[model samples]
Target: MNLSFKKPSVDTCSKCDRINMKLKYAFVDQATNLKTLKEHQEAFKAAYEEKKANKQLAQSSEVVAVITFDLQQCLPTTYLQTNVAFYKRQLWTFNLTIHDLKTNKAFCYMWPECEGNRGANDIASCLYDFIINQLPNLHPNAKKLIMFSDSCFGQNKNSIVTTMLMLVTRLSPQLQFIEHKFLVPGHTHMEADTDHALIERIYTCQEIGTN
Candidate 1:
């Protein structure tokens, strides 16, 4: 007589499910926002430190080399009514490394031809060869290698970038003996002061002369 029927557990309705989904999404969004904020903070700190170091290096009288490469695309004057064919044109890469006289450290690689049509591996190899063979012979006391390149194909290529990084890491023991450091992708003005701006000026002159 005192026994009562057990009530069935209510299933979650569609509206409740939708509300739960929205709550889950809100949490995910919040987490993503936090992660982004942390990343931005880290990047800012790193950038600030790099700017300070570069400014000090620039003021120093040590040897600094700016290296850069440039590529030019020349299209033929064929006015075909159908489709236009763009030739490979020409790929020109330049490496200019400057030395800070007082410190005797070379710090700069300027590659203007890294953008459009050129391969990243080519640029990376050029930088590697220049540092390992060319610069050392030029300045025995040269210890630092600073490279400035556009956010172009060369910098974005994983194979090229990885290879360059691997080479650097492998050479860390030798580099450490001379206090060598590599810099890539900082402020534009820093790069502009290096071979990036100079290369553009030279390339423009070359183009004008060719035409």
Candidate 2:
């Protein structure tokens, strides 16, 4: 990965001389809070380097994909009887986000109206369906799979998920290797978070308009 910073260069041509740059603003202090600022910069740099490396590696015939899955808690519109007079029903949404390292494309699958309890079996079932049914259509040439998920015991990072991946490798002729990894317990911020945020934002907008 290229670690050298590339300063913005000026374009010469009149028709295509426009410069495109993106600036991100966040509150950071380097005076007394140098540690925090440095940590943030290191994290950002690490992510950038990894992405660059993935892009370079994706050009090969080996297909590279990073997948993240999680369940989102959502409040339902209807109500039901409970210990209290009435309570709004709650639902769980299983969101699977796949980021193709080669093409830098993101795909999201949301399964709504899910039951409250989510175990390894449920997670494995959803992943299996995607792998066997949907993934081939999306990336027919992909042979190796890499998956990332939170360290939650019941939802992911368990024997069930490992078994599922192994089964895929064994059953699918196109798949050669499968690897599943658990993100740090508190540091799992990936594409799935962005997917969840978008869903939440859309739901919030709908609620406001309805009101």
True-structure lDDT of candidate 2? 0.61
After best superposition, candidate 2 residue 1: deviation in angstroms? 31
Question: For residues 1-211, could you state the per-residue lDDT of candidate 1 as single tens digits?
Answer: 8988866332333433444565567666656566555565566457546645654664562444333232223322222223333343444544444444334454444344544334666556655676676655654544454443334544433566556756774774334322223323332233324444454456565655652
- Positional deviation of 35 in candidate 2, in angstroms? 14
lDDT tens digits by residue: candidate 2, 1-211: 8578766332232211111111123233424344544455566556545645544655565565545566655434422235552443455455556555555556665666554246788778878987898778766888777776667898787888888888888898688987676654444665566666776667766765652
User: lDDT per model, in order?
Assistant: 0.46, 0.61
Local error of candidate 2 at 59, Å? 6.0
Q: Looking at model 2, which ten-residue stretch has the lowest summed lDDT?
A: 14-23
List residue ranges in candidate 2 displaced over 4 A: 1-56, 59-62, 78-116
Candidate 1, overall lDDT? 0.46
Per-residue lDDT, model 1, residue 171, is 77
Tell me how far the alpha carbon of residue 138 in candidate 1 is from the true structure, in angstroms, after superposition: 4.6
